[model samples]
Target: MAANAISPVAARWIRAWLILLGLLVYATILVGGATRLTDSGLSITEWQPVKGALPPLDEASWLAEFDKYRETTQYKLQNHGMSLAEFQFIYWWEWGHRQLGRFIGLVAVIGLAVFAARRWLGGGLGWKLLGLVALGGLQGAIGWWMVASGMGDTDRVSVAPYRLMTHFSLALLILCVITWLWLSLRGAPRAAAPEGRRTSILLLALVFMQMAAGALVAGLDAGRSYNDWPLMAGELVPSHYIQGDLGIRSLFEGRAATQFNHRVLAYVLWGLSLWAAWRYWGGALARPFAVLAALVSAQALWGILTLLNAAPLTLALVHQGLGVIVTLAAVYLVWRAAAPATPSPVQE
Candidate 1:
């Protein structure tokens, strides 16, 4: 082994640590989806990174927290006359989401510190790990920003759609990066296929765009509208595709427009995935493309079901979780497709 190389055992330890952290991040995303679905995101009303770790302990503390939430536009306009018990319900959800985030940060920092202290992280891997930690911190800030949008003096009853999209998009981006790093540590590069690599990259990009589109749909509660298949409101395009005065912004803000966009992107992604699967069948990229095609098909179907059912909590979360899985699959394909034709020197 080279002087700077990380031992196989050390690499495995680092990989295991990353895998655990990745799973936590994945859970956090799901919890966030649940928070949105249940309208619990704005319940906390404050971003106390340290002091906020502990939820309201007694009735007075709980009421104090609830009192703060009562001032938000969402509580005033939407949840007016809500009971204290009901308040606790939403508060707990938001509190859990934030607590989970803090836990992830703790685990990430501690793992990096331990690995670095033991000199297990070599070949600049320590810096990469540190960068992920930094992104995690940024994500926490973005979460608070998203929550703040609803608490402001506006007619909005929930977080701004664009900010929600931004926060969700960043979470997925971090997940992709973590996945790519984990895949890199697997060792033994496969022979690269340029054509397949290009296709894989295209598919990954489409999947990511579709996720962002889905976020907009969730943000605007668009899936609850036009609950029909093949056609929205019995037309190829809804008559009110751009209902709001937001004009071009309607694509992201308008319920009809956002849902329409999400549906269109899903169709495009589904077709592209199937095509890639067929094109790469019996080739080096066959398995990954096949898995991608299957996942895309399932995701599209679930999405439709989610729409038809008015985006129920259970189905919506499942759809969102499956989307993450599909994304990880795409990341894996990209990593595999981009491998060097010959093995490269292994580093930690």
Candidate 2:
């Protein structure tokens, strides 16, 4: 190996570290989804990067926290009569979510430091890891911004749908980057078909867009109302898909509109996945595309079941988890499709 080249052992260690960090990020996302589902996002009402790590230690501290929450629009308008016990329930959920974020940041920082100290992050990998840390910091801020929307002096009982969308989208973006970095660390790459590469990129983009749409659905609690699939409320489209005067904003603010959009995009993505798989069939990219298609099918079906059940915590979390898996798979396919093709063995 060249004197300046990265050690193979170091590369393997970095890959393992990234995989661990990716799983932590995945867990944080799931906890975040649970927090939103339980209406626990607004429970904290304050963002303390350091001090907030310690939850209420005694009854007085708990009361102080609960009192602050009581002043929020969510409590004032929606949970006006919530008891202390109920407040504790939601408080713990939000706390756990934030705790997970803190732990992930700690792990990332420590891992980066160790790799840098050993001079193992060669080939500009250190800069990439730094960028990830910076993104994580920004995500934490965006998280607070999302929560603040509901805490302000407004009638909203939940965070702004678009802000929530932004936060969720960024988390997935981080996860995708980690996955890409991990794949890049694997042994020498194989050549990719240009057409297949393009198709995979398009599929990944659509999948991301669908995820953003799903976040909107979650932010607006849209899935709970459109319980019936194939048709919403016995009609191909909900009668109230468009609100009276909201215009373009209705798509994000109106439950019917958000749910309808999510459904339409899911259908489009599912069809595209199948088409892409068939296009690349019998080729080097066949397996990944086929797996992508299968995951899409299962996700679409699970999404419908979640809707029919009014987005219960368990089913909704499973749907969200599956979405993450699909996204990772798409990321893998994209990576695989971009590698240089390996030369065939020389014929006799």
| Candidate achieving the largest TM-score | 1
lDDT of 1 by residue, 243-294 (tens): 6578888888999889988888899999999999999999988999999999
**TM-scores of all candidate predictions against the true structure:** 0.97, 0.96
Q: Across residues 1-348, which tens digit of lDDT does each residue of candidate 2 receive?
A: 544456768878988999999999999999999999999999998899999999999999999999999999899889999999999999999999999999999999999999999988766678889999889999999999999888777899999999999999999999999998887767555566666888899999999999999999999998899698789999998888888888789988899899998999999999999998898899988999999999999999999999999999999999999999999999999988885433211111
Kindly give the stretch of ten consecutive residues in candidate 1 with the minimal lDDT sum.
339-348
Question: Which lDDT values do the candidates have, in the order given?
Answer: 0.89, 0.90
Report the Cα lDDT for residue 335, model 2. Answer: 84
Q: In model 1, which runs have C-alpha deviations exceeding 4 angstroms?
A: 340-348
